[model samples]
Target chain A: MDFNIFLETSISIAIAACISCMIKICTVTLNMKSKLDSDYFILKNKLILAKKENSILVNKVVLCNEINSKLLQSFFEVVKQLLSLQKFIFEKGQ
Target chain B: MKKKLLSFAFLFLTSFCFSQDHSKIIDSLKTVIFKKPSDSIKIKAYGDLCWYYRTESIDSAFKYGNLALKLSKETSNQVGEAQAYNDIGILHYNLADYKKALKYYDASLKIRSVLKDTMGIAALYSKIGLIHQNTFKLDSAIFYATKALKIYEEKNHTRYIAYIKSNIANIYRGLKQYQKALETHLEIADVNKSINDNLGLTRTYNNIANAYLFLKDTVQSEAYYLKSIDLALKYNYKKELAGLYNNYGGILHDMKKYLEAIDYNTKSLKLREELKDSYGITSTSLHLAGLYLDLGDFNKARNYLYEGLNLSKSFNINELKMDAYDKLASYYAFKRIPDSVLYYRQLFKSINDTIYNSRITKEIAEVQEKYNSAEREKEIQTQRAEIAEKELKLNRKNTQIIGLVTLALLLFLLGYLLYNQQKLRNKQLQKESELRQALVEIETHNKLQEQRLRISRDLHDNIGAQLTFIISSIENLQYGFKITNNKLKGKLTDISAFTKETINELRDTIWAMNKNEITLEDLQARISNFIDKANISASNSNFRFNMDEALSKELVFTSVRGMNIYRIIQEAVNNAIKYADASNIEIHIKKKYEAVVFTISDNGIGFDINEIEAGNGLSNMKKRANDMDATIIYKSQIRKGTKIILSV
Candidate 1:
């Protein structure tokens, strides 16, 4: 009878140990899932911020390109006027 | 009368020098300019000389072109200055100095546009496109080529139109747009033939052959190649002929006619050598190496490959050197030399890394150039507008919104996918852990049941039988007293003595069974006992097994883990006996480098390690070593038994 009790106790202990291990695994998995969700949210927020920044940069580049074109055009026009005057004088002299 | 005769002589000589040809005209003009030291005539003479030598000698052409530029600057002749810049740009382009060529081309374009020289601008655009094509910027090449084509078409310049068409075709070929390339080449070829332009026709034929080759139409490719070759030979263009031979060799090499390929490549190599063409030699050597490799002559292949690699390296030709490294790696792999294969693979990787970086640089340069050119065009148009009204505001606004929208969409998708993947992974891990726990529980329960059954059977078979025999003996003793016989009494006494001895043996068995739980100390004691037995057995030879004194008595040993360690030691000992056949053995166990290390060494007649097969026992040892995440090394030499070292 004592041996039977011993066997029953050992079986019960083994089952309890398995149940505890499974609970630990489930808890760990749940913790990991929460951490992953948090990380995802952080990354998503960062991506949105980066997108906003990129849009601003693109706007700035476009504005700069436009201003640069205008300046170069005015500069070229002045130079062209000077060149025409010189050509006119040279042709009139010839 | 003598003075008049001398004057006539001088006048005739001067007129002859001026009227002979452009080169003679340039020479006489140079002398005149040297005497007078005037800028206008000198610039004209330098410009003419630059045009004359443009195709023949790039250095001299550039030199004279620069001289013209300087003279034009002194005379304030913008037209002459622009022409000189264009000539210098062409010379640089011919020399493959694209960066410098682009600078000169841009300078000439600026001057030409200022002077309203539309033809000059168109020509400069063509030259820029040619530079882009040579640098493998196919899209930019096509853009400029098309711009030049439009201008030439508007001016009704048929010859210039044909040239632009050919340039566009070359760009298309570079882009692998075979159908477009072929159509353009055919149109250009017809125009050139109609105009009786043999030089242009030969180039067109070569372009056609390249397009057909890209289309994999070998017959058409060969036909056009032969036509180009014939024209090249007839015109005595050694450079073009060399290129033709190399192209033909590549085709034959692709066709698997190695001998013919080698023959053609050798011809090409000879021509290039005569021409002092280092780049051509690098390419031809690579083709020859391919031929040798295809013929299965690895030694010859390696010889050519290494030669090509050295030449390419010396010339700083990264592309050809990369090819050579790839071929060498393959050859070493085919030869089954693992070390050589690994070395050449590393070389191949380094070369590829360099090529990737260079490609990225090339891409960035191309984009920059396109952006700059577009900006220049915009600047030109904006000069005509009085008020700088912002036309790009709407475009910028639209682009910003589009960029933001796309980025938002991409980010959302990425986050969604990542979330889903994480959830899936967690589910899988949970399931795996659950399964593992179930297996462990089932195995432990089954083992316990088997142990109990075996114990029950042992008690029933041994002790039950012994007790039954004692009961029968007592029953017979009672009968013996009833009989009252001296002999029967003596027999009963013997039976009692035998029964007492059996009872004592049963008690001892029970005690041994109760002592079966092993402790750490008990494990160490058992190992020591085995070592002592081994020492006595190996008395003829010197043997030592030592454990570190620093080992703690509190060190726990699970039976299963302990059995594995014992088995590993046993296998090592058996291997030493069978393979090492050593006269001396030393075994040591200690902690080192954060690991427990077990070492066994012997000095005996060792066999060639390379000849030993990794049999089942060795495989098992390796697998167990892996299970423990341990490293095992067996080192031996001839006439030296072996040393097996394990770190866990």
Candidate 2:
């Protein structure tokens, strides 16, 4: 009986807390909407600035990939030329 | 004594017309209406004229009021239009045209509601209440008066609350709830006093006196009547004075004071005529006739009875007309004229029966009005409940959407972190493999270089000495001997030159076999040495190399893998010089997310990756990168430049 009473009280407190949180979340969320459009997750200026930084990072990645590939291609050409040169030298020496 | 009473009565009754001549005001207002300064001003001036001529000339009042209504509508001044309609309703109400009065009041009410003019709405409701009161629709009267009182109370329009409450008190009196009427009137009296509204208090006093009269407290009734009369006379409220005098005369008539009743009724009738209070005039005329009959003056009685009947017929006052017929029957019966009495009695019965039927019809209407009002109240409650339910549901929906969105956001963040972690682990593995491969290459190169060094030493210490001796003997034979074949000498010279060239070639082969394990510092030094060589060869070009601060200088790698990296770097630098016409070149190695990233870039004319990637240009590089478990990405555009990133 004591356990039952305690459980009931605990359940009531939990329900009360849920209701309070719902109300507070609504208030905070609505306050956020008052400043920003619904589609966005952040302030206009902050989102724009974040996007700008992301764009720069993307450009850097693209440029890096291009440079790396160009470098690797040059190295492969040198290796191909060296192998061909070695085959000629071995054949001619024999 | 008669002259004194008449003079005093005249003085008090002289209020509306005597305060100022209404004709002069009407004429001036007429001129103002013609000279249209502003339509709103003209509408107001016309409304004033309507009020001024309401009691004086009913026809002129309606004409000017309609003009005001027309002008207000034309200018789209809804407030002025509402006021005009209210004035017109009052004019109709004064003439006892209840149907027209109610219609105009409804029109004004619609406008006031649209405008959200609560004060104007309350006033129209009070006026409608008065119309219902006059028409004897007591239920509707109380309903409208209560509605008006509630609005007035809500708005804290205290003075107007007393007015509506006074009207409600009168409705209670009509309902024969005399005690309730008396209580309401008493409260209203106090409210009027607090506001210093002497005229409003007088109306309350009159209602209280009537309630007392109905409750059989004649002394109390007379006392309240006198109190009301004193205030009415002081304020010269002619309509209120008229009502008070008639009611006081009723008390006097009951007390058998025929002469005093005649005096009060005379004053009431005179004032009623002045105010054009049609119902008041009809009632007072009948009462005065009854008074004259009580005085045993047949001539005066007959004359007043005829006057009352004519006015009642003209105004369609059927209830008072019946009373007039009854009184005529009594007058004829007192004259001992059987035929006249019979005629009047028939008239009375017919009119009374007609009134009874009309009263039944009116009662049906009143009941329907009450039922409709209740149904309207019920419908409003249902709508209110529905609206509240909708709002609660909407709020819950918003809460749920927010909850789901937050949950989704948390899930997405978790997913992103897991993916990033997997990527980091993969990069780490690839970097380790790349370094391990470099270690393998460096070890293999070292072993091969050791074999080459041993072979070269063997050639230099043993076979080179034998070759040197052979060469010297051949030289001695060619120099000491006198005669020799030219072909044989040339062959010997060819052998010496070939031996010397073979040794030089061996030295070159030994030079190509070099390092064992490579460190980060060694790689940097090697790259710098290569760049220095390139700069000397391609003097106009510049090269730069950068290493991450977090990368250790002593980080070691295998010979073959280091050799591969070195060869790739050399190949890339050579290509940049040979093909790219680039002015500057840069190589950057950094630790990113626990993975080592190598970026090779140049400010040169770039190539299209779409045109480049489809070719077999990167096949060997890709194969080497796959062996090391390293990933390489190449990006380039024409004139933008080329960049390559290797992550391991």
Candidate 3:
């Protein structure tokens, strides 16, 4: 009877040890998975913000270019008008 | 002499009437048109009046030109129409509106081309070339000038030829080809002298001197310049004298004679001031600034540059303003004022970019305009040729129609033949489209039939054979049950058990097929249960199974992939059970980045890993892994149990 009890105790201990080892491994794997998910969310947020910033910068650059072109066109028009006026006055004097 | 008298009379009637009361002349011409209303007289009156008011009153010129165009069109008179368009173009040219000028010039050229008026066309070319030259289109200027020269030479119009040569020479001067410019000017001078054209002679000598100056031939340039100045004084040409002084100041400035440059520039400035010439004043101020800068008087230089900059800006002369900004930048840099230097540099760059971009825009527009005009000419030529062909064809058709009308009784017989020909053409087109659609439909039907046959073959060859074998085994088991021998009973029992197992496997296959839509959570739970059962059956080994809880519960696998994974795990466990005398086995299921991973390990007496060949079971495991696009690895040693890792 004592031997039977000893074998049962050994089996129970082995089962307990196996269960404990499995629980420990599962816990470690779960922890690693959660950490990877958290990292993925962080990188996704950074990429989204970067994309938004890049778009805004591109819009500003486009607006600046438009303003520059308009200003140049106005300057050219003014120059053409003045040159015409000068030529007209010079011809009248001649 | 009569032609000369008529030319003078026309010039007098136009110029003197404008000098008198312009409105009265317009009223008188309108009254005459209202009374007589003759198309030829109306066109002549409008043309004469347009030339009179072209410079001083552009609107009145446009009105008269339009009236002349209307009258000329009413009479279908090409000469009158060309004259009206040319007058309108001259008015626009005087207004410095080159775009409007080009439009009228094109219209005039079109009418003249229709009339085959070579002289009128050549005159229009010269006018257009002058406009292009004034707008700084040197290449176009050269092109039109050459065209006009060729036409004048052909007509033996020597005076007009001299004028074209002088225009060409001026273009060469503007382009900075000084040697070519001098040669042309010399030719003009010789021609003018031969004709005793005193005004032309004066202009030619001035142009030659300008060319020599550009070539840096100081002695000849100075001599010619003096002669030009003397002639202007003799002619009392105040405007010409001012220009001569300005050119002389520019030359003196280039020679580094600062005081002489200042003196000549002052004289030019005084004359320009008297004349109220803002452009000339601006030029003299710029020259004075350069002299001050050379004399090391920074304050005076700044004052003069500022003055020039204001005048140039107010006049809207960007080129002069750009020059002033360049000078200002240098002055500020020399003054050692960093901020002022930077500001002026920025101003310089802005003006420079504006000028360059504007010039490029203008050039591109001009090139496109030229291309369009050339295309239009080509189109007109094609149209003319087509019209000529059509006219010839129409004349032939008219004659044929007249002959057919004369023989009206023959017309009914040709109609049936024409109808039959058209019917044949329609049939040919219909047949072509019908054949095309039939070929496409046939190909699609053949492909569909091939797919159906492949599916039917797979069903009959695989599942049908397996069912037939099971049926035969079952019949044999039933027959053996009737035999009472102990050995036969054992054999029959083994056969019965084997058939039952095969039935169960077939049922499992059906269940797996039905569970195609199972979620990953359910699959994981089933796998865990399977591992638990395996652990219970496994002797002398403690089994452990682990999984990641953080894996998404909604994850799913396709039936084919799920079945592959299950088979691979089953094979691995069987190998462990057969070969590994392990005391412990661990099965791990976890998520690895984007993949699902399964690892099975046992601590046992391992075999020589490298020497072991893949047996049937191992190969089956590899095949199952391959079906799922999964990777499998087996690690073993002589004394260590094997480990199998699978990733999908």
Candidate 4:
């Protein structure tokens, strides 16, 4: 009877250990979910900041495009005037 | 150009708003929002409004904080949301709603971590540290303060670093590490001075003073207190001034300077009231009341005690109320007002008991909450185990049922087989016993027949020889003597014939007794021989024997029946030859239905069977036929012929 009790105690301890191991595994899985949530939120914030930065950059690019167009038109006007003056001087010299 | 000017104007206005009173700043922020400024500008205004209202009105602060949060979410402003959460946390902290403060702070911390807002994160860390410090969690306070300090130091934010260091020093002081607390405070003071943070410097100095007081160095404490006072007054640091005055009053109270203690305590209370520091008011009120009570000014003590009591009730501060009650009891006793003293004493007892019970209850509730959470988890585990155990038990039961059924079937089959085997064995044994009995009976009958045959053969051999001898002697006597007398010769001849007849009968008896059964063929052969003999004896007569061809060769008769039938046939033939004096005789044996018919006829002198009395020969023949279970008839005729018929 004493031996039977000892065997029962040993088996109970083994089962408890197995249960504890499974519980630990589940807890680790839950902790991983929490970590992933944290990472997701962090990435989301980063994405939002990136979007804001992108918007600012887009605005600057549009402004620069306008400036570039204006500068090209001015350069073309100057070139047309120079070409005409050169043509007039060449014709008069001829 | 207009946008830049507007932004500049907004910054100027915001800077101006920070220096104004709470109501004015709130009004300015309202106007800014009313003007339909850009969403960003409006969000900023809301955030500022929340911070300004935090100490003055918690509800208004929460309202604006929520507005800021909503606007920021609408605009997708992560930084604005983080600032809103921080402002709300501060408001709760100032209102002494530490639990709500911690929750909001944690929310802010998460956002700030997400936004990578280092400065905001550091500032939140310090605030959280202060909450922990207030709750007497020194280890947690130190942890958070150290985290903030590390970040601030990395960013080269000297002012923030100094502020965090000062908080850490306060925790160290709470832990009773006065030397470490004083060293950290002194170091933070240098950093605060370097950054020209007069408010931070003053706070650091006040912390150092408290540390010195804890160390029992009154001179150093007094010097540090004076330095902190100078900086606090110069910078108009109302909060720090109130705290410094309270601490200085406590030191004076401890030093037995009653008047000084009362004056300092009163100043601290007035400043706390002006600043709306409800917690500070309760503390300084109790101190002033107790000091006045010690000075024997009953009215002043009573007034201050009542003020402290009312403030403690308003703020729900039990420690302050407990102190106020105690001081009131002492004051009434000093005045020799017995009834008033007793009343105050009872009041003091009641309040003390209430505070003690509330503390104990709060502690128990916290422990119970933890225990309940653990029990809930354990209950879930136990339920899972129980389900598994039940499943196992169910499976075991099913297996046991199957095992029991199989065992029963096997037992039933075995029982049936055994019963069938036993029945077969009993039948076999009964047959063997019957066979053995039959064999024994056959053996006994064979032995008895052998004994009977031996006895009959011996009698035939011996009796036949003796009869033959008698006949021979009689014949010899008659021949050899040649007797002249006729009667003597006749007698000798009769004796020889009689002996011859007896020998024939003896032979017949031996034939019948020696065999168990006889065939009809044997009887016929015996009867045919008798007829031949009769023919020879009667020289003037001829004999004929007839048998049915249809009589089966396999037909048999028992010994007794054969003997009886043979004798009946022999007697009939003899009677015909002897009595009838027949010239020729015929005998016939025929089957008629299941019976045999025997007939003999003679052509000789005949007599009527009715006229003649039955002699021994005829009677013996009839008797022999009866023993064979056969019917016999004798017939005779005169003149024409004599015919005898026997039917059996």
Candidate 1 residue runs with Cα over 4 Å from true position: A1-94, B1-62, B270-281, B295-316, B330-341, B357-648
Alpha-carbon TM-score of each model against the true structure: 0.43, 0.50, 0.40, 0.47
RMSD of candidate 3 to the truth, in angstroms, is 49.4
lDDT of 3 by residue, B1-648 (tens): 644544454445555674466567766666555555446766888887786555336577789889888889889988998899899887767555678889989999999999889899999999999999988888889899899889999999988899889999899889888899999999988998899876677777888889999898987887877787788778755556777877877778788888887887888787776655666777788878878888888998899899999988887677778888888888887788888888988988998999899898877887899899999999999999999999987886675555545344333323343454445445544554454444444444444444443443354334435544644654665575575546545544444444444444444343445453446676677667666767776766777877789777788876556656766777777678767878888888889999988898888887776778878878888887886678998888777778888998
Pairs with backbone N, CA or C atoms under 3 Å apart (clashes), candidate 1: B604-B641
Model 1: per-residue Cα lDDT at residue B364 = 83
Q: For candidate 4, lDDT tens digit of each residue in B8-61?
A: 767887888756777887887787677677888888888988887765666777
Which parts of model 2 have CA positions greater than 4 angstroms off?
A1-94, B1-19, B27-37, B110-122, B136-165, B177-212, B215-238, B263-267, B292-303, B328-462, B465-648
Interface RMSD of 3: 49.9
Docking class of 2: incorrect
Q: Against the unseen true structure, what C-alpha lDDT does each candidate score?
A: 0.70, 0.75, 0.72, 0.75
Best-matching candidate per DockQ: 2
By TM-score, the better pick of 1 and 4 is 4
Fnat for model 2 comes to 0.00
Candidate 1 Cα RMSD after full superposition onto the native fold (Å)? 53.4
Name model 3 segments beyond 4 Å from true. A1-94, B1-120, B174-176, B266-285, B295-311, B314-316, B331-338, B358-648
Cα lDDT tens digits, model 2, B298-345, are 999999999999999998888888899899999999999999999989
**What tens-digit string does per-residue lDDT give for candidate 1 at B260-348?**
88888888888877655667888888888888888888888888898899988887777788888888877887788888888878888
Where model 4 places Cα greater than 4 Å from the true spot, the runs are: A1-94, B1-5, B15-31, B54-63, B73-78, B154-156, B337-648
Q: Is the docking of candidate 4 incorrect, acceptable, medium or high quality?
A: incorrect
> What TM-score would candidate 2 get against the native?
0.50
User: Chain B TM-score in candidate 1, rounded to 2 decimals?
Assistant: 0.48
Model 3, range A7-90, lDDT digits (tens) per residue? 545555655555565566556556655665565556556555554444333333332333334334433443454455456546
| C-alpha root-mean-square deviation, each candidate | 53.4, 20.1, 49.4, 48.1
Candidate with better lDDT, 1 vs 4 = 4
